[model samples]
Target: MTITIRSALMKNFLGDSPDWYKWVIISFLLLNPLVFFLVSPFVAGWLLVVQFIFTLAMALKCYPLQPGGLLAIEATLIGMTSPAHIGEEIANNLEVLLLLIFMVAGIYFMKQLLLFLFTKLLLSIRSKMLLSLAFCGAAAFLSAFLDALTVIAVVISVGTGFYAIYYNVVAKQADNNSQIADDSLIDNPEHQQIMEQFRSFLRSLLMHAGIGTALGGVMTMVGEPQNLIIAKNAGWGFVEFFLHMTPVTLPVFVCGLLVCLLVERFRLFDYGTKLPEPVREVLKEFDRKASAKRNRQDKVKLVIQALVGVWLVVALAFHLAEVGLIGLSVIILVTSFCGVTDEHDIGKAFQEALPFTALLTVFFTVVAIIIEQQLFSPVIQFVLQAPPSTQISLFYLFNGLLSSVSDNVFVGTVYINEARAALEQGLISLKQFEMLAVAINTGTNLPSVATPNGQAAFLFLLTSSLAPLLRISYGRMVWMALPYTLVLTLVGLLCVHYALVPVTEWLTQWNWISPPSLNVISSVTAH
Candidate 1:
């Protein structure tokens, strides 16, 4: 009886995951406190950061939130980071939290409209290359104005819908043939190969679209949450922020589109998988049936969602309200007008966003630990000690390197605060400060696409319900994003070193950027 009870307890603790994973997590938890005492709190904190990333990398095997949150709780208890510090991190990023919670859910409610529009594009565009370009361009445009994660959510939904339609048709066909085994349909060699090809096709387009987000996301103040933070610290409004980023962002944007075209045309980096003809037929037939069944009311709902989507874009572009608030308004307007009135239906909308929101909060705890440990201080200090002539480019390179591994928002927040301190102390001129601000924004946004770990949107897409079905793993994402990463980072570096510096100097010489007056300095110092 005693042995049976122990076995049941172990089983309960392990749940559905493998026992080895449970032991691995337990080891991570056990090893941290020992490291904290044996080495140093700083060393232990760094170890914890590494362990948290390990959990994220193994996300397909187990949800990272459980183990990551456990690590966070252990860190607090062991004095690596205080509960108060974690709370402070959360408070500092409340806008981001609200955006994830409400904006994602808002996009969920708009799926009918999104699906309708994407379905039309998929059906009308016969050329695979053109369709890929359309996806990339549309994703870039939307991400420029809306949140990247929200835009990716729409893309994922469309991909998932198409896969479901194809699979359902395949399943029905298998049922009609006795030679095909329903249980082995996914595992059959020929069928699996075709599915793999289809997945590769989806993976390529999704990567293009994901990279598109990064391209447009660096263009404006509202393109990313970190951009807003940097902009606010610099005392720049919407227009000023746009003008500041334009020097680097615009050229990078053009180069990014060209890279998209080149990659598809040359079929490089695991791209160029054409859609299987049978699957294409399945999707086309599905669209036809869906269209034939649509009535006047269905058309009206699509129209209503379109109007609400337009409103969302306009509101975000004008900085009408906090993004989260605008997203909340979108939810109310779309649901009420489009007849999504049932409480259960609304509850379903929250399903996709809430888990990610919780994971984001857990991420803040890890960031809190980084703060308590001062892990990034040495790097920031070293960069600040560089000559003023090279500081902007160094800032860009440092930010890109760090943001590729850590959270960009946290990195941006820390660097901007440090830069602002330098400005207040008269260590850098206002022109230099503005240039560093641009570097911070573009740095954090652009190079972070090298891995999903760098960007919240990429990570969200990697861990979404769609990823497993599409066979997109962490390593796979890195490989797929490689070409884009090389192009964007190189182009961004060149623009910063050569183009941005010269343009800013020209603007300053022409009085386009006024010297820092006392009032301006005071305002910056006060903030």
Candidate 2:
């Protein structure tokens, strides 16, 4: 009886994960204290970070929140970090938390509009290459002015809605065929092949859009949360930020679209799957029925959503308020006008965003541990000691490598603060400081595309409900992003090394940037 109870408890610990994996997690927890006592808290803290990443990499097997949260709890108890430190980290990143909560749910109300637009595009475009380019381009445009995760939420909703419609049609056909013969719909090899092809097609388009977000998210202050932080520290306004980033981001943006086209044209990295004819017919019929059934009220709802989407863009462009607050306003406006007032309907919108919100807080806890242990201090010190001529390139490479494994926002914050300190102490010139700031922003933004672990947007997509349905796994996402990663990283490095200084000089000459003697750094680095 005792043995049976113990086995049951073990089984309940990681629910459905393999027992070997469960033991591994348990061993990690058990070994941390020993390492803390014998080796050092620094080594132990690094081990905990590695263990947490392991959970994230295995996200398909289990959601990382529960296991990762457990590790966070252990870290706090063992003095790697304190509860107060975690709370402080959360306070520092509260805007991101609110953005995850309200913006994602806000986009939920606009799915009908997104689906209708994408559906029309899908039916109108015959060339798969053009279609891929359109998805990637539109996603990039939207992500530049809005949140990347919110843009992805819209994309995922459209893809999932399409899949659900086709799935239901197939199910109905299978049910009807059961009454006629043994060759049912599910038993047909050709039908199965078509379904697989359809899945591949959606997977490619989704991956393209996901990469598009990264490409555009590096371009402007509003493109990412960390961009805002970097801009605040540098005292750059919207136009200044855009001009500074254009040297790197604009080139990468064009190259990214070209890569999208070339990959589809050559069928590289699982990209060239065409929509099967049968599935296309089903989608066409569905779209036709949807169009025919649309009434005056449906048209009004779509128009309202379109207007609100425009407002979202304008508000963000002007920096009207916090992005999260604007998202909240969008939610209130769209839902109140679109007849989504029911308690149940509103609750459903929160379902997708809330889980990811919880997971993000857990991530902050790990970031707190990193901060408490000074895990990245040595790298920052090494970069600061490099020759001034090569520091920009070195900072870019260092940031990219660390951001690939850790949170880009945290990496950007730490590096920028260090650079600001150096500037304040007169260790670096004002001109050099500006160049390094650009390097930090572009570095954290561009190269983190190598893995979902680095960017919150990628992680949100990987953990989304659409990922499992579309058959997009962690390894698959990494493989698909390889081309974009290489292109953006190399191009961005060259720009940082050569173009950054010249661009700053030109901007200063044109009276667009403040002169070096103005003490503008005091105002910009206030945060």
In order, candidate lDDTs are 0.80, 0.80
RMSD to true structure for each model, in Å: 3.9, 3.7
In model 1, the Cα lDDT at residue 387 comes to: 85
Task: Highest TM-score: give the candidate number.
Answer: 2
Highest-scoring model, lDDT: 2
TM-score of each: 0.86, 0.87
**Regions more than 4 Å wrong, model 1:** 1-21, 34-39, 170-183, 186-197, 276-278, 417-430, 505-527
| Model 2 residue 473 lDDT score | 82
Model 2 CA lDDT for position 466: 72
TM-score of 2: 0.87
**Number of backbone collisions per candidate:** 0, 0
Encode model 2's per-residue lDDT on 204-232: one tens digit a residue. 98888888888888887767767866776
lDDT of 2 at 269: 92
Cα lDDT, model 2, residue 297: 99
The local lDDT score (0 to 100) that residue 476 gets in candidate 1 is: 90
